[model samples]
Target: MNVATARLGARALNRALLSRQYLLRRLDLPEREVVEHLVGMHAQIPVGPYIGLWSRLAGYRPDRLSTMVTNRELVRTALMRSTIHLVTPDDCMTLRPLVQQVLDRDLYTNSSHAAVVKGLDLDEVVAAGLALLDEQPRTPADLGRALHERWPDRKPDTLAYAVRNLSALVQIPPRGTWGGTSRTIHASATTWLDRPVDPAPSVETMIRRYLAAFGPASVNDVQAWCGLTKLNEVVGRIRSSLRVYLDDNGKELFDVPEGELPDADAPAPPRYLPEFDNVLLSHANRERIIPDGLSFAEWCRRYGLMMTVRGGVLRGNLLIGGLLNGIWRIDKEKKSYTLVVEPFTKVSKKDLTALEKDGHALLEFAFPKAESRAVQVLPSR
Candidate 1:
């Protein structure tokens, strides 16, 4: 494959990524279609996908996704990076098997549980765990206690962790439902989705999807996003079919032939992103979306404002003109919810006004039942 001499600057790559991620503009597509297009949403936090979809989809409703969860059309399961993701049943079946190596490596190298499970027969453990989950979905603690009956010498939680990493377990519903709180429960993905893992999962197809959603990226970027390694070989195999370009830094980038590259100056309205939004986390070098300068944490420290986490979810980010410029969080009180926006640097009045308007809309979507709603912008220090 002859490498093209075309070049793309950071802004050009940024626009292309934002356009692919639907951040440049909201789309009227169905939530399921959107979820599939982006591969999946990082869903360690139950509310993360709800807020993610709300920001990217037109007329998005939490109930629509909640209903999907209850119906088993969408599942929260361990997939990319061995982290829980909200994905369609089709993706779960296909992707879980494809990334099984990442999960296996994580189990053997994990500091907390690796030593305990060192000599045990992990295949036997996985089979037993799946049998138990097939009978009924169970929380990790409950599953651990049951597994302890067999591995009398190991820590119950450690045994459970082994099974979690070894098997394709899907966190059953009511667990991921919106406005609902429940213990994390697990069932075998085969049992939950009534589908076996894909016998022939495709790495090439996975790479193509990644590029479509978060691409014009380097090989390192693809590996970073999926927690896989040695993808350079896969990219090489498909190189001739890809459009090649060099970033300003001269790193080679790859994209699908039809991947859209919007103008560098395309208007990017203020977008409120959920905690762990894939757009921010999907790239190895996030300079395309997160502007170069002081890191976000450093900026927060300089301003004497801490980026807070509540119930395990970090504060959502504030994106202005296609770059991550600030952070926001919703503070819940007895009868009200307050949306707070804090910029890393001084923001112009025009940008602040736009942020406030969109911020209010987000407040309404996330906390419509609150007796009062307020949006506050902290002055840049």
Candidate 2:
């Protein structure tokens, strides 16, 4: 297949991603449909997906997602990149089998647990863990202690880690629900979802879905998103069916033929995104959303805030006009809620006004019954 010689600049690429992500405008779709469309959402942080969906969907409610969890319509599991994601039951079954190798690789190479589990019979350990989980969903510590009784020589947590890597376990509900305070609990996906892992999961189908949601992307981008390697061959097999383009850096990008590329000057409203949103983390190259030559630490420094290691990783990013501009967080005190924003660069009064307006709306959505709410945009140093 001949690759299209068209080139997409950063702004164009950013808009395409925003359009596909439903970030360009809030959609009035069903929550399950949106979840399935994005494939799944990054859900390492429990409230992250709720905030994410709230930003993308019109009239989104926290309880709707919580209800999905309770109904087993959606589950939180370790899938892409071996991090917990909120995905549909069908996707959990289909995608887990494809990424099993990534999980296994982590199991063996992980410095924390590898040595202790190196010579142990992993299959036996997995069976034991499953048996325990079958009886009831368990926390890692509880499961670990139970398995430790069977394998007295190894650390209990390592045995549990083996099961975590080898088996498809879903973090059960109330655990991932919005405002949920439950301890993390796990149960076997097969039993919990009442369905077997897809015996024949399709990497090509997965690739196609990636393109539909986040494409005009390179082979490296796909690997970065899914944590799978050597997909050049699979991409090669399906190249003829895809539309291709060159990014400004001359990297090859592939997309479904019908994928929309909005005008580079498209208007993008300011959005508040939760930490670990896939839109920020999915691509090998993030310059499309994160502006080039903008140092996040320096940006925070200019705003009189010291960026900590944890702060660096767990940031709620602010987007304006299709690019990252600031970081934000909601603070609670007594019966009040505050949305605090720190911009990376000095902004116009107009942008600040827009940000403040959206910030108040977000606060209302996140903490509806707070006695009071406020939006604070810290000044640049």
Candidate 3:
């Protein structure tokens, strides 16, 4: 196969991500299919995947996603970075085992829990935890208490963490289901989905899937998303089969041979992204979405200053014309709903008008039952 060497700057990278992630326009696809394609959205925050889907899928209904979760078609599990992600059941089965090392790294390498878990019989812990969860879904506290009784010598927290990190424990509904109370109930991915985990997981396939969704990325970028390192060998092994590029800084970037690159000057519209959306979290270098010199953690800390409402804890982000220009929040009253946009930099008068128009539309989507809707813009900080 002929390989193309395209030099992709931030805009080419930005447009590639927008097109691949279906952010440029809503795609008429099932929620499950979209979830699989993106390899899953960052779903640690409940209601995040719904808002994420709303942003990318045409005519998306919360009920469609809720039903997918309720019916066991898609699952909320610790896959990438050992964080909860909403993924199709098939992807969960394959993706979980591939990233098992990421979870293991938390237990073995991290100092916080390393000594506690050391010398502990991890196999027994996994078996015991799985047996308990097989009997019924369990909260971490409940599972920990049960394990404590069995291994009274060890801390319950350690045992619980071992079980969660070792075994493929998926959070079951009403956890991720839309418009439902989220409880911390866990079950074995094997038992809940009634499928055995893949014996051999392919790193190459995982990287390919990632590129199709979030690429023209570097080795570090893929590592950042999956939380595993030492992929220089894996990336090198597949080098010949992939198209390569260089970032403006001369960093090497890789994408699947078939990946699409939109024009660097393509027009991108305003998009409302939920807190912890993959666009912000997936890349090792987030300069395409986040402004340089500002870390994501620092940005969130500053955003907390503007947070006024008490609702879901995740802060939503605003994407205007392909760059992350601001942050936003949704406040609902008994009779009305308000969408507030707080831009990080000055938005043009024309752009502000366009933003408010989309904000009102988002308000309707977010609070369909409210009799009144309003959009407000705070002065740029």
Candidate 4:
């Protein structure tokens, strides 16, 4: 449980994260179980959750997850530092009280969100939103307008953030379902699940769950991953059970007692991750695992965007390697996808073949079945 045992070498870290994130091999477990294991699923692009499950499950079932959302087993709620996530309905309840601390912290000076919601009655807004949604779920815009009728002076934008984010709500199914493209509307999580929400549990439990999935990390990493703050004390209590290691830069990292620290020589293969993969967003220090040459910044202009979300960014698709190699976009008009791979540098024939295969799969998974089904290899300029 000391620095040396936790050193774990670099490749060891990569394998552990990939395995824990369900990327190394597809597992055969219930969809709900997987969601719980990962704490929650990263949900930026609505359909990304299905592909994410596909990449992780042994034989994936889109229906099961879709059904869960439909049946209220899973709910789409803004969570974990105010980012969207597909968490189990139970988590939605249990995690809310724990999340309030995060929202409160952001209201302070020099914070990114900076009390964008100051002077608002958070509870009243929550009740008003629930009342509007009780009749039928409404898109965020629809709900906001309805609420605005009651409070004319409030900035609808600020009011909506308070109701939708600060309170308990879910993005009903069909919005987040496979092939159901539409704007996000808000629904009351309580009404949708027909279950009373649980008060947030101790931060200690939250820290343990995060470590179970993405451990051997620092307190800062946990905060970054969850978008929560004020947890140094929870870390202190768990320190006895954790093993610590110094990063290449000499910062101490903490991990679970059972977290696997594999062999330094473990070999990893190329992995095509969905947008905002937990692997990409789970660390305060992403470079610790993502090689410097392949850091996502080259692909990401902002936090949620990537050069390629589904397939290709704006006209180019990305041809990435073990690290990000480069980005690309196709020039097709309709029904056809030409591979315009712009690797970081010239790739060998073997690597080119791999890139082509990965790119093709990404396109098929990204677009509707009939559209963009064909991938033509274009001459790299």
Q: Quote each prediction's TM-score.
A: 0.95, 0.94, 0.94, 0.83
Candidate 1, residues 218-327: lDDT per residue as tens digits? 99999878999999999999999999999888889999989999999998888888767788777777788877734445534654555433432226777877887777
Q: Go through the candidates in order and give each one's C-alpha lDDT.
A: 0.85, 0.86, 0.84, 0.67
Higher-lDDT candidate of 1 and 3: 1
Candidate 4 lDDT over residue span 129-198, tens digit each: 8888899988877777887888777666656666765667888868888667667878787888887777
Better of 1 and 2 by TM-score: 1
Residue 341 lDDT, candidate 3, scale 0-100: 80
Residue pairs in clash, model 3 = none
* RMSD (CA, Å), each prediction: 2.2, 2.6, 2.2, 3.9
Candidate 2: stretches off by over 4 Å? 293-315
| Steric clashes per prediction | 0, 0, 0, 8
Q: How good is model 1 by TM-score?
A: 0.95
lDDT for each residue of candidate 3 in 1-381, tens digit (9 for 90 to 100): 324465788888999999998998888998888998999988888889998999998777798889989999999999888899999888888998899999998888767678888788899989999999999999988999999998898888888888989888889999898777777899999999999888888989999999999998999999989998999899889889899898989889999989999888887878888877888778889877767724566556665643222353335888877877788887766777778788878788777887888777777677778889888899988
For model 1 the local lDDT of residue 125 reads 84
For model 2, the run of ten residues with the poorest summed lDDT: 306-315
Greater lDDT among 1 and 2 belongs to 2
Task: Compose the digit string of candidate 2's lDDT tens values, residues 1-381.
Answer: 767679998889999999999999999999999999998999988888888999999888899999889899999999998899999999999999999989988888999988998789888999999999999999999999999998999998899888988999999978988777658899999999999999998999999999999988999999989999999999999999999999988989999988999988888888888866888778888788867723444444554655511242124877876777777877777888778787766777777888888888888888889899998898842
Runs in model 4 deviating more than 4 A are 1-4, 59-64, 104-117, 293-333, 337-342, 345-351, 358-372, 376-381
